[model samples]
Target: MSLLFAPFKLREVTFRNRIVVSPMCQYSSVEGMATDWHLVHLGSRAVGGAGLVITEAAAVSPEGRISAADLGIWNEAQAERLRPITDFIKAQGAVAGIQLAHAGRKAATEAPWRGGQPLGPERGWLTLAPSAIAFAPGYECPREMTEADLDQVSVQFAEAAARACRAGFEVVEIHMAHGYLLHQFLSPLANHRRDGWGGDLEHRLRFPLRVARAVRAAFPSHLPVFVRISATDWVEGGWDLPQSIRLARALEAEGCDLIVASSGGAVPDARIPAGPGFQTPFASAMRQEAGIKTGALGLITDPAQAEQILATGLADMVVMARELLRDPYWPLRAARALGADVQWPVQYQRAKLG
Candidate 1:
């Protein structure tokens, strides 16, 4: 039997397989509302046989959006629009998941296809962060946020979690990775505060842990909550594996069900040794050391490679992004490639070999 195709359970949710449709930003929303593009984009992956289909970074607040067109769950209207998309995904026998995020200094930037440049005041507003810092050259220097700001933002995340649960989502993954808002606070490279919210590892972890606790309290206990974190900043003196293990343990204490292990995005200058499954080790390490389930990500492609990951217990689940975009039916195809039986949608079952 293929471990990759085996069912996995967390909280009250049982995934049909260990394959997950990693959230990929579409940059196609209008004013934070998911349009028809989202329904089709997300629905296709569910129909394609992914066990869980997670949405792109859905900002918890308007200011948390990475781009003006990012998906949001802050308001009822925005959450309401996601109903049909989630319904379709569930109809395909896939769990509907959403990643709640805050971009911080990364906010107010154009989409990648638009060169990912910092937006002008005419298009984007001011941004906030733990400290006044810019992500890179050409990005705006964010304003240092106050304690009040932190408290309010934490509440925003909780409210977003509640909204996501109401939007027909069964899973909520907190986006704390990729040099976004939470990671900025975790990495000393971005957070240079000399206060309780930053400095040493304990201080730095304060806000993130607080947000996780609040989100857990707001979300239903029957469902699982996952935190996507950069297992390493991929830079010297930045967030590394040891720190990540500690953070993962702390998150687990805060009721996190799993950690989606990814790396880098703490800075643009870090040398990332990108290769096939370069990050799988991080997931394995986190799972063993932190004693928490982990979802392996980053450059992991191919059916055999995925099966090996699960077979060896390198990760509890594997999230795929670029590959899924290239082939929405990848999970179904992967089952065929592995000689494992997986159910295809009724309309498409005729194409599967008897």
Candidate 2:
């Protein structure tokens, strides 16, 4: 039997295969609401045979959005819009997951196609961070967060997870990676605060851990909560694999079911050895060192490559983003390539060659 095609059970949810459609932001929302575009974009992956279809970083608050067009679930109205999409994914035998996120100092930027440049107050609201630091040139210097701000944002994540449950999502992945809110706190390069929320690794982990705990508490008890974290800053004196392992262990104690191991995005200057499965070692290390199940992402493209990652125990699940976008049916192709007998949608069964 192919391990890649074997069912993966976490809590009460069981995935049909190890192929997960990692969150890829569409940047097509209006007032933080997911539209028909999101439904079609996400639903197709489920139809294409991904076992777990994770939605993009759905901001926990308006200010948490990476851009004005990013998805949001801060309100019930926005949460309700996701029900149909989740229902469709469940109908297709895939688990529907949502990643609750806060972009922190990285917020209020234009979408990638729009140059991703920082916007002024006229176009975007003020951003917040652990310290008064700017992400890079042209980015606004974010206001240093107060103690009250931390409590409020933590509650926002919890509330967002609760709303996601109402939206019919089975899993909630905390977006603590990609130089976003929580990750900035994790990395010393972005977070230079001298207070309880920074100055040391434990301090830096405070808020992210609180948010993860709160989210886990708010979501359904039987459902699993995953956290996507940058395993390394890839820059010296920044967050590294060892720190990630510590964070993962603490998170598991707080009920995090899996850690999605990814790297970089703490700074633009850091050198990353980018290649096929370049970051798989981080996932491997995180799982081995932290004693947690991990999802390996970054440059995981080909079908056989994904299978190999799973079969070799490099990671528990293989997350594919750009590759899945290029071929929504990559999982189906992978299943056949691995010689795993997987069921195709009735409409597409005629196209099956395996």
Candidate 3:
């Protein structure tokens, strides 16, 4: 039996296979509302046969968006807008999920295709972070989060999780990675506060852990909650694999079901060796050391490579981003490539490969 095609269970949700569509920001929303673009983009992936399809980072607050067009789940209307998308995804035999995020210092920017620079006062809003630090040279200097801000952020995440459930998402993944709000707290390079929310690793983990606890409590008890973390900063004295393992352990205790291990984005200049499976090692370490389920991300494109990662006990799932964007039916293709018997959508069964 192909491990990549095997059913995987967490909490009460059972994926039909190990293939997951990693959340990818589309930069295609209007006032943080899901548009038809989201429906077609996410629904096609479900029809393409992914076991689970996680939506792009859905900002928890208006000012938490990475770009003007990033999706948001801060309001009931936005959550209601997503219900149809989730309904369609589930109809195609896939578990629907959403990644709740706060961009922190990285908020208020233009979309990548539109130059992706930090927006000025003409369009930008004040950003918040663990410190009054700018992400880069031309980036906005975020205001240091106060104690009240910390409590509010935690509450926002919990509210977002609850909204995700009402929107029909079966899973809610907290966006702790990619140098966003939670990651800024985790990485020393970004967070420079001397309060209980920063300083050492323990203090840095406090806010995120509290947020995790709140989100877990807000989400359904039976459904699974996942966390995506930047496993390393790739910069010395920044967040690294060892720190990630500790965080994973704490998250697991807080009822998080999986660690989607990705790396870097803490700083703009850290060198990352971008090659296939560069991040699987971090997933392996988290699973083995932290004793938690992990998903291997980053350049996981090939069927054989993905299968090897699971067969060799590296990670429980393979999270695909670019590959899935290139071919939404990648899981179906991967199933055929691995000689795993999986049902194709009846509408297209006539085109099934041998």
**Against the unseen true structure, what C-alpha lDDT does each candidate score?**
0.94, 0.92, 0.94
TM-score, candidate number 2 = 0.98
Lowest summed-lDDT stretch of 10 residues in model 3? 345-354
Query: Can you list the residue pairs that collide in candidate 3?
Result: none
Clashes of 3: 0
Q: What is the lDDT of residue 91 in candidate 3?
A: 89
lDDT of 1 by residue, 1-354 (tens): 998899999999999999999989999999899999999999999999999999999999999999998999999999999999999999999999999999999999899999888896678889999999889988878999998999999999999999999999999999999999999999999999999999999999999999999999999999999999998988889999999999999998899999999989989999999999999999999899989999999887899999999889999999999999999999998998998888899998779855
CA displacement after TM-score superposition, residue 324 of candidate 1 (Å): 0.4
lDDT tens digits by residue: candidate 3, 1-354: 899999999999999998899999999999999999999999999999999999999999999999989999999999999999999999899999999999999999999999999997678999999999899988878999998999899999999999999999999999999899999999999989997888989999999999999999999999999999999999988999899999999999999999999998989999999998999999999999999999999998899999999999999999999999999999999999899999999899889943
Worst 10 residues of 2 by lDDT: 345-354
The TM-scores of all predictions, comma-separated, are: 0.99, 0.98, 0.99
- Model 3 regions lying over 4 Å from their true place: none
lDDT (10s digit) by residue, model 2, range 254-354: 98999998889988899988999999999998888888899999999877788788888889998989989999999888888889999999888889953
Task: Report the number of the highest-lDDT candidate.
Answer: 3
